[model samples]
Target chain A: MKGILKIAFKLLVNDKGKFAALLMGITFAVFLMVMMTSIFSGVLRSASSVVINIGAKIWVMDPAVTTVANSIPMPDFVQHAVRSINGVKFAVPLYSGSATLRLANGAYQSVSILGLDDTSLLGRPELLEGNITDIFAENGFLVIKDSEINKLNNPHIGTTFELNEHRGVIVGIAKVAANGLFGMPTLYTTYNRAIQYIPSARFTTSYVLVEPKSVELVQHIKDEVKKMGYVAVTNEEFRENISTYYKYKTGLGTNILIMTLISFIVGLSISGQTFYTFILENLDKFGALKAIGAKSRELIIMIVFQAGFTALTGYGLGVGLCTLMIGLAKMRLPNYASVVTFGNLGIAFMMVLIIAIFSSLIGVRKVLKIEPFDVFRG
Target chain B: MAKTAISAHQLVKWFGEGDARTNAVKAASFEANFGEIFYLVGPSGSGKTTLLSMISGILKPDSGSVTIDSTAIWTLSKDELADFRLNRIGFVFQDYHLFPRLTTVENVAIPLILKQRDWDEAIQEALRYLEIVGLKDRAQLPPFKLSGGEQQRVAIARAIVSQPDILIFDEPTASLDGDTGKKIMSFIKDEILNENRCVLVVTHDSRIFEYADKIMKMEDGAVTTIENKSEVK
Candidate 1:
């Protein structure tokens, strides 16, 4: 067993091209999954950050607050009731509405307007090209960096804009927006100012932020808030909730699930078939091993190790490519976009690995059937 | 008393079934003592390789049995057969089936490592055997980097590295040119005669006749003749 392992290891390192291709294939798959999931997670995180980053220890929102990227708002009384409970430091009201920003070219790009209090505590851009608090001025508003500016022929920072029947100044240009959620640029302004443009403000979008006395009190705090006819969720839980919804609801989960299954089949066919072909090509070698007193189990281990090594290598290279991809996305994207995660990386690796190991079984079965005697006659 | 390294008593092997079945080895029986160069020679499909495989315990004979060092080789369990092979038998093939990914030294060390020998010790012994084959310089290069002749030498090194009591060769020189083949034969003979290790070779090349201590010819599925082989071919 040790002998076989040593040989298999050496074999993988010897053929640089085939070995590298296998490794890269695996790595690329890993990288793809990791980067895609991470970016997806990152993007959704940014969308939620509108509320997530507000120093809020807990989030109180509508029952459907599983996802906040496009979460509908609840009544102000609910926010007040949750705030009234003990251990709540403060609760602010936040709201979001959608509108179209007109480019000088007479074209329109969709943008979501976020309403914040004068304290600016509910939700705001973490990274912005201009000031976030400037939204306090009735004449002031924040437009996402990607909005009508670059996409619409580079609108100036101080460009005047019309939205929701309210003409407003671009007091500040938010540096980054999240592309994963709603597929629209974002704008930020005062809650009162936002109410003017959106009559639906009577229904508050989300409770701004909460600060617990201590981390240990988070659960109790959440329980008390949840009892008030609102959902209380931690930041991480909130993020996962939104991701889970997108992953399950909207049938995106189904689509992704189908796509994932398709990828599995494709990977299995390509990697597995290639491995089988490689074994067929090397039948003679297997014969030699048999004649040399190698057992069926030993050969099985050998081929399996080969396939596993190839998949591992490919996964690694795939991950490397994904890393480069993430770097590129971070550089090229205007919004705070994310790619894959380590967990996603592991998933891709395991999938490719399973394909690899599964694919090698065919060769192993064939090798086991070879009669060492037949090798001598030919 | 010196024991025979291998003994076969009316061993039979068949293939397929019903109308498709064919007897590959018909009631073949033979024995070779330790340190003798035993030859099984015949044309293609003459059952020379089949008999060799049966005696080597690679196939279970349909009838009779094979005993190597008094152990019923073909009748033993699969693991037992493997253990016997690991501890007592070595094999070389015409194609030199050396792994393309491994260096000569690594290939040679494989058998010993199979027994869980330490890496350093296995490598040293492998190098020692490779040195015997006069190819230590090519040790680090992958088998592909070497010539067909060099690769065969490496295969020899790998086979003999574990110092098995019996060494089997399947058309060991079939793929080599005449000169290289002759050279390999001489090397094999020297190792057998000097080291006292049993060498069984199945071949059509009569040029190796002078190297064998005894030669048997298989005309059909059984041995037709056995030559003393003391006289020069």
Candidate 2:
């Protein structure tokens, strides 16, 4: 088996031009696949950035909410009801809304504002500078230092901006786990102040953030919340719901899927055609091997080994190339949202495996049909 | 008495169907003994190759059977027949058929590799066979790098490396000049043939026919004559 595999390898690589062409086809396919899926994965993660960054155990919201960014304001009674539920350690009204900020440059920019509970400051972003207590001062706000921070002229602690004719001071510079998908700067303020600064519906609570007393009581709390015509979901479930909404209900998902399928087809056609040509050209040699006593099974193994080796090599090259490109893009363009995840890798790997199998089958069919007599008769 | 190594009993083969049907080999019966060079000669389309294919266990005869060393080859299952070919026969093609990517020694090691021998041991054994063909110095070169005669010698070395009981050469010298052909035949007669092995040569190249101990002639699809060279002499 070792010797046969050695022969298989030699046969594949000895034709350097064909081998290189085969690798390039698969490598380009894998690059496109990983790039498309990674960008989509990153987009999904960014779309749920609020849930990921807030790190809440449970969120109580209107049942109609599909994503965190598109939150439907819940009435004040919902938060009070959530707080009254058994197993609820605490429930705070979270105010999430968009507001236009007038930067120091006098240019207007859209910003996402999150209002934490005034007393507990639950879900406040970690401060990179200044004191967290400063958020309670008059007109106090924490500016999140993310990719879009420069939109507000890169505000630091003590930087002041105008919102709805009200003075807003950056009391602290903060960092969160993920940046928003939309190109908007994020601001953190107290719940009462947020509603005061930004005009909203009569009900200003976007979601009721809940912390259960214990893990075992989470289901019971969810059941209790459901009776109030609101949905209760854990942090992970909320993120997943956002991901599902974006993936199934948006054109982005279909576009990415189509691109990935096209990449697979391109790789499959090129590799399959090239491999079939290679086998046709080597038909005489295969016939000779057959005539000299190589079994059909052995020939099939040789073809499979050749295809699998080429596919794996191309897959590695593609992943490496995509990683390098993504890294370089993120360095030069901060807003570049593409991440390489294990799921992306697995998808590309499965596609490459399918390409290998399809190509080898093409070659194997041609090889098995060859008769030594036909080869020798010539 | 010389022991029989190959026996074909009234073998027959045909191709196509209906109006296009053609008999490739018909009732061909013969015996090839150990320690002698047996030649099957015929014109183009005279069924020499078809008969050889059947006798070598590659093409199944429509009727009758072939037995090598008393084992009916046609009666074995497909896999068993393949194993039989791998273990009991050594075939050399008209074009040498050496894999161009492989070094001469590696080409010689193919049969041993197919037999599941250790790669290093097969290479070592192949080198020994290359040495026997007087091409040990060129063992590292690819088949295309070697001269036609040298390539044919490599093919011969590859065939005999497995030490099979029956050695079949199909038009061994069809592509070579007369002197090279005679030299290949001489090399085969001198170094390859032994008391325990049967050597069969299929060719219409009469220039090297003098080396054959017995020559079987075919016309159309049937054996026309069998000549014992020593007896005639």
Candidate 3:
């Protein structure tokens, strides 16, 4: 078996150009699989970052709020109902609104405005510059993500802009997980102050952010809030809800899945054709092997060794390139949200293995049917 | 006669179907004893190679049986036949069929490796065969790097590495020049043919007929006559 594999390796490497072409095919497939799935995963992560990046243990919202990205604000009094629940450590009304901020150059850019409670400041962006206390100033202050600084006309500390004719001052610059997928900057302000910045029909809160006394009490609190005729979800459950909505309802999942399948097909064809041709070209040699007493099993093992080695080498390089791209993006683009999770790596591996097995079987068909007598025909 | 190493009776093989059917070999009966180089000589389409293939256990005869060393080769199970071939028979081809990617030594070690022998041990034994064939210095060179004569020597080294009881060569000297052909034939006769082995050669090259102890002449898929040389002269 070891000698069989050694022969397989020697044969594959003997022709450098063909080996490279095979490797290239596999690498391109793995690259496509990893990159497409990663972008989809990144989009999901960004969609759920509202729940994931915040400090809340549970969320209370209107029953119609299916996704964090498309939430319908609940009545303000829902916070009172959540605060009354047993095992609830605290409850605060959280405000979220989208508005156009007029820049110093007179251009208007859209931004997501999040309003945390004035007293608790429940979901403040981590301060990279300036003071967290400045949102409580009399004139009102807003915190902007560092990635969105250009959208605010390259604002420095204490630069002020206008939103819906209301004066919006940038008190701090902070690092947030990712801006929305369309590069929408996020601005943080006090709950009441945010309502004044966005033109709306009523002053309603999007969600009630609740902290439970213990992780064990989250279920108890969720049930109590549900009794008030509202939907209650823990942070992880909210993240899943948002991910599922984007995955199914918006057709993003379908697009990524199609791309993944196309990549697999491309890989299969390239590998299959190359391996079949390779075997055909080597048929005389295989006949020679058979003539010299090599079993069919041994020949099959040799072909499999060739396929598996090709798949693994190409996969490792593909995955390595994906990681390098993501790392560079993270360092260069603050709002770049492409996540390559372990699940994505596992799926890509499975894809390559399938390609390996498929191509090997295809190549093996020709070898198994070879007659040792063929070599003697002059 | 010295103990018969191989005996075949009334072997028949056909190709294709309907009007295209043609007998490649028919009712071919022959016996070869140990310690002699037996030659099958004929023109193209005379079924000389086909007969060699059948007797070497590479092709099954349509209606007859081949017995090698007191065992009916055709009656064994498929795996057993394979084992028998690996342990007892060695075939050298006309094209030399050396894997171009492997060195001469690696090519020679294939039979031992197939028998589940240790790799290092197999290579050592292969080197010994290479030495016997007068190509030990070229053991590390691939087939394409060797001259035609050297490649033939390497193929011979590969054939006899396992010390198989039956050795069959299909036009081994067809690809070589007259001098090279004679040299290879002389080497096989002097170094490889022994009392414990039966050596069979299929060839139409009449220049090296002096190396044969027996020559079976064939025409139109049937053996026409058998000549016993008794000695090289």
Candidate 4:
């Protein structure tokens, strides 16, 4: 088997032109696939940024809420009811709404506002400057320093802005776990101030953030919330729900899937055609080997080895290229949201394997059907 | 008495089907012993190559039996036949089908490699056979770098490296000049042939016919004559 593999390797690498063509086909396909899927994953991550940064164990909200960004405000009674549940350690009303901000320079920008519970400040971001308690002061809010921070001219602790023509002051500079995807800066304030400054319907509580007393009691709390005509979901389940909504209900997911399928087909066609041509050109040599005592199984192994080696090499090159491009883009453009994850790599690897198997089957059929007599009779 | 190395009985082969069918080899029978060079001579379309294919366990005979060294080759399973061909027969093609990408030594090492010999051991054995063919110095060169005669010698070395009991050559010298052809035949008889092996040569290149111990002539699809050349020589 070792000898046969050596022969297979020599046969593959010795034809420099064909080998390079095969590698390039697979590499380009993998690059496109990983790039598309990684961008989609990063977008999905950003879509649920609020859930990720808040770190709440359970969220009680109206059943229609699909993503954290599109919150459906529930009446205040839902928060009261959630707090009254037996397993609930604590529950607080959270107000989430988007408002236009008048920057210090008089330029206007859209910003997402999160209103944390005034007493506990349960979801307050970690402060980079100023004091978290200062959020209680007159017109005081915390500004998150993220990729979209510059849209507000890079606000500091003393920066003042206007929301709905009401005076607003940044008391703290803070950072969160994830940045928003819609190119909007985020501001943190108390629930009372958020509703006072930003006009909304009478139902202003967007979600009721809950913390269960124990992990075992989360399901019981969810069942209790269900009876109240609302939904309760753990953090992970909420994230999955957001992912499912984006994947199935939006054009973004379909576009990415189509691009990935195109990449796979491009790789398959190029590699399969080139491999078949290689086999055709080497038909006589294969026939000679067959005549001289190479088994059908050995020949099959040789074809598979050749295809697998090319596919894996191309996959490595593609991943390396995508990583380098993403790194360079992130350095030059801070908002570039493409992440290389294990899931992305696994998807690309599986596609490349399919390409390899398809190419190998093409070669295997040609090689096994060869007749040494026909070759020699020529 | 000399040992019978290959014995064929009433071999038949046909191609196509129905009205399009044509007999390629028809009831061809012959025997060759160890320690002698046997030549099968015929014109184009005479079924010489087809007959050789059936006897060498490559093309299955439509109706016949071939016994090589007392083993009825047709009765063996497909894999067993492949093993038999690998260990018991060495074939030389008319075009000297050397893998152009491989160095000469690697090409010659194929049979030993097929036999599962260690890489280093197979190369060493191949080098020994290359020396016998007097082309040891060219072992590292690719087949394209060698002359027609040298390439033919590489094919010959590849064939005999495994020391199979039967060495079959299909029009071995068809692409070579007369002097190179005679030299190849002379070299094969002098160094490669022995009392334990049978050498079968298929050719119409009469220039090297004088070296054959027996010549079997065929016309159309059947054998016409078997001439014992040893007595004349």
What TM-score would chain A of each candidate receive against the reference chain A?
0.83, 0.98, 0.95, 0.97
When superposed on Cα atoms, how far off is each prediction in RMSD? Answer: 4.2, 1.8, 2.1, 1.8
Output the worst ten-in-a-row residue range by lDDT, candidate 4 chain A: A330-339
lDDT of each residue in A234-303, candidate 4, tens digit only: 9999999998999999888999999999999999999999999988989999999999989989999999
Candidate 1 backbone overlaps, count: 29
Pairing residues by index, what is the TM-score of model 4?
0.96
lDDT of 1 by residue, B1-233 (tens): 44587888998889899999988888888888887888998888788877887888776778988888778886678877887887788888777777776778988887887777888889999999999999999888888899888988898888888778889888877888889988999988876444456889988888768788888889778788888687537
- Per-residue CA lDDT of candidate 1, range A1-378, in tens? 666777767655566765555555455445555655665567556556555544456777777666665667777677677667777777777765676766555677776777776674455666456666566656687766662346545554577766656677777765543443556656777877777776564576555466677788788877886677677787777777877777777766566556655656666766666667667767877787766667787888888888877777677677778777778766766454665666666677678868786877787888888777667555
Best by DockQ: 4
DockQ score, prediction 3: 0.71
TM-score of each candidate? Answer: 0.82, 0.96, 0.95, 0.96
Runs in model 1 lying further than 4 Å from the true structure: A1-3, A46-49, A54-90, A100-110, A119-138, A142-180, A183-185, A197-241, A295-297, B1-3, B136-153, B176-183, B230-233
Clashes of each: 29, 0, 0, 0
Assess each model's interface with DockQ, reporting 2 decimals per model: 0.52, 0.70, 0.71, 0.78
What is the Cα-based lDDT of residue A240 in candidate 2?
93
Q: Which residue pairs collide, candidate 4?
A: none
Fraction of the real A/B interface contacts present in each candidate? 0.62, 0.64, 0.64, 0.77
TM-score, candidate number 3: 0.95
- For all candidates in order, the CA lDDT equals 0.73, 0.92, 0.86, 0.92
lDDT of 3 by residue, A161-193 (tens): 788888778877776655666577778889888
